[model samples]
Target chain A: MTSSTSSSPPSSSSSHSPSPSFPPKSHTPATTAAGFIKAIESGSKHLLIKRFTLRYPEQKLKFVGDGYQFDPKRAVGIAGLRGRHILYHDKCTGCQLCAITCEGIAEAIGMVRVDEQWKHNKKAIMPQIDYGKCVFCGLCVDACPFYALFMTNDYELASFTKEHLIYTPAQLAIKPKYSGDVEIKIDDHGASHHG
Target chain B: MADLEDRISESQKMGMQIVKESDDDRLMTLSVGPQHPGSGHFRFIVKLDGDYIVHCDPDPGYVHRGEEKMTEYRNFIQNIPHLERPVIHDSTNITYSYSLAVEELTGIEVPRRGQFIRAIASELNRQVYTLYWLAIYGIFLGHSTMFMWPTGDRELFIDLLEALTGARVTHAFNIPGGVRNDVPDGFKDRCLRQITYYEKRLKEYEDIFYNNPLVRQRTEGVGILTKEDAIRLGVTGSVLRASGVPYDIRKAEPYDVYNEIDFKVQYMKTADSFARAYVPFLDMRESCHILRQLLDKMPEAGEVRAKLQANPRGPPGEAYRRVESGRGALGYYIISDGTPKPYRVKISVGSFRNMLALPHLLVGAKMGDMPVIYWALNYWPVEADR
Candidate 1:
């Protein structure tokens, strides 16, 4: 916020400044020859230049020492954050708080109800996330009334076709299959049934 | 002459009068943002006389998305990933802070494996952010080579991140108690290769950009912030470190696996833009050092998530948590009211706090020097706006 200025007295013309064009009266040939030799020895021209950069893809980098080390299974520390998607299908109580919080940027998630199957049974409605539109904002996960929907760190939703991106009930099941690998189940217990 | 007379007559008819004022008497009000490339998303108005800045006022809230108001409608577990977009470059740190707040409220102890992964992800993010800063700094100095090298080098790390998380920017990898997934097969080899590549490339960066005489000339003594001034303005992270404060959130408050790691918080005594730029360079080296240590110490195989006491209901209290972000300290304040959703969620972004000191640092500097100064600050617009 504060400004300070310093000014030095102006110098005379360049011609009046020390001119190297004139020979020094006390210059010695032997001293000049020694100075030239020193300059040549210290110059970068004689030093070996490095070509250390890699030609990537064709020539990949190799790390020294031990190989790849992955984290231990079920190893949580003082501060650990992971992805968890919960389905509170029964406690949902038909409130779309999640949709409201999604900010509507991607329209990636919604709630739907399936028709009743039996005589007296009520229709079943549940929240579904369309991975295609889900920016993974987690707002929809947070907006659930029953804590039924959550985000999982199982983010390998890539596919050859865009159609595969649309996640359904079976696709988003507690033990969903992702990228040909079995999804890591948090526990052996089945999905929680909340009423 | 006729056009000037007509303009004056039109102004008089429109009730706009010109008052003659002395140069020393009248204050020149200059507006410095909203749309200005130099200022991020916010604006500043400064009153000045000659080149000396007098009073400065910053105007914000333009990019505010009402996230706090919006959080009231979202559920507990769902909000974790929702909060990362504001500071996506430091995604792990942002999500980790929120997770810590929720864990504190719910009394959930995180697993060790998850802590290590969070540390690795955060350090990778730090490296990427520093690379981006270096690129921008190069652009500011009109050195295209410096700009291109780091960005190209950053792609190597990004590819490594993509391999680990399956996503680039919005990994949303951290949950309340642990990380979402464990590292995949071959991830260790990929990360190690990237580390080696970066180590070699860093020397080239030092030769081409860090030690470049032109860059040093432009940044060496520009926008100097003293230790007293930085502390008074509440500057944190590298900016504070540049002033010889030696206070880093990672050190002051060791969260995650930082306590277990062997790394040093880099500092410089200059406190100028050059020092600020230099700190990130050293930080990149520190990140590489930490990455090597992490690779060495990381467990072979284990579950990444912690076991929570069967799905518990939302807590009735609130908790606030802070962590070191790429820019500085990012904090998240969350309030739960016994419901599945949070009542209020507030995030204090590092870029916003860092950019607040811009007017103080920018004034009196020539207009041509603005871009270099802005680049050296390394403020992300989305984070600042959010």
Candidate 2:
């Protein structure tokens, strides 16, 4: 029944090429030679152009802003890369909204009791995120109504041990210095990575 | 259904008896996937009588994370990241369907600009996903350059996506109310430039991959799914269209500015492996045109996201919405009970539906034609097993 409705063709574009039982000439020596020539010609042309690949670790792509930030009034996220979570201890109320939100999702953030006593944070707790299970979806950043949490440009969270992969509140507090300006630039030659 | 079940069971019994009898014969069983690099997180058993396959059994569920069950635990907003997990590459459309369904349940009106932006994201994701599929399909059929070009060219769209959504692969951009955020400044000019460049690069794809006689010989007339068979089997996406049905959800259903946009529903009457492959290429060309139109027609400024309560809830009801994803007709059916969490979420995916045609086509195909026939079906394994 559903198929019957969807079976009819909508308006056709000029570029639309409807096949009409046209047999493919695969074995013809002429077509085969031409196909090979054209395929090779298109491929080798890229050899003259610079490679699109970035030598990672040695070169990092520059980001636009400090990181993903949320405005309580706007009720929307500012456009930025989703990398690692950053926590501002001064702003955190220890409301556990971030922990509540992360429960069903990544469960990456764990509320750990902190040593310092702050006026804003009555619970004396902060979110310690485990990068191991975290998808970096950045929902934890969105849940922070107090503007205490946001994702930084630091994506390199790899470690030798599983225990070390978990970033403590103190570890998450430090801002990452990631810099290198690389963007995909297109020109007459072709699209290539430029820094 | 009963007759089909009986026939399958009968065949299985006969096959089991034949296996006992043909212990001395030249029948060989080759298991592809679940661990193989050639197959994505999927497994299929093919009984090869010499070079030709006598029987085929596709075993999915390798990467099944119980997504529907998981959705029950998470609320509507929290479910976005979880739902996009299945088809991570084509995350926009996967979540688009969910957001549509959720919006219906919650009654959040997406702004005009937001709808256009959502549509643009879906089309770009379609390109990203199709290029990825084409890349793997190329390598599967021994065309290494075909693999390299599309994979490289895919970055153009991925770059555009990263700028728009702030992530490369698993965007998780689409939310219940609208997209996560608006497109950044100077995005139009950059998008136009990259899209035009990508369009130019597509012609080269034709020269190397589609028009190549080597690929043609291997693909053409192999696993010919007739129009009647395609319809009877209930296949969707390019696979169904390649069998001469111009059934595009964008055209037929007309969700999110697709009704206004002018684009062709790419279909071919030949119903061969070549037709299946060619249809997506044509679709890509049309997507370029649609992207241009969408960018030109979009509003200058508007509220991209709807203002909603912290824990948004709607009255008890169910809503179902479908979108034309790269794989096929991806849909979400959500039932809400005036709560933050969804009571039930059913994902009706294209890859799973396309899997129905696998055994039907693979039973009689030659071993050499396996990859071509299989990949040409547009079956993304993770999505199917989700």
Q: Assess every candidate by TM-score.
A: 0.68, 0.93
lDDT by residue (tens digit), candidate 2, B1-386: 99966876797786432245537568887789888877788998888898999888888889988999999888888888988989988999999999999899989999898899899899899999999999999999999888888898887788788778878899888988888877877889988998878888888888878877778888988998888888888899998988888777887777878878877777888898999888888888889999999999999988788877778889999999999999888999899999999999999999988888988888889988999999999998889978
Error of 1 at B380 (Å): 2.5
The per-model DockQ list reads 0.05, 0.52
Candidate 2 — which residues are off by over 4 angstroms? A6-28, B1-26
Residue B213 error, candidate 2, Å: 1.2
The per-model lDDT (C-alpha) reads 0.63, 0.84
- lDDT for B53 in candidate 1 is 64
Highest lDDT against the true fold, candidate: 2
- Any runs in candidate 1 off by more than 4 Å, and if so which? A1-107, A111-132, A136-195, B1-30, B46-56, B309-315
Give, for candidate 1 chain B, the lowest lDDT window spanning 10 residues.
B15-24
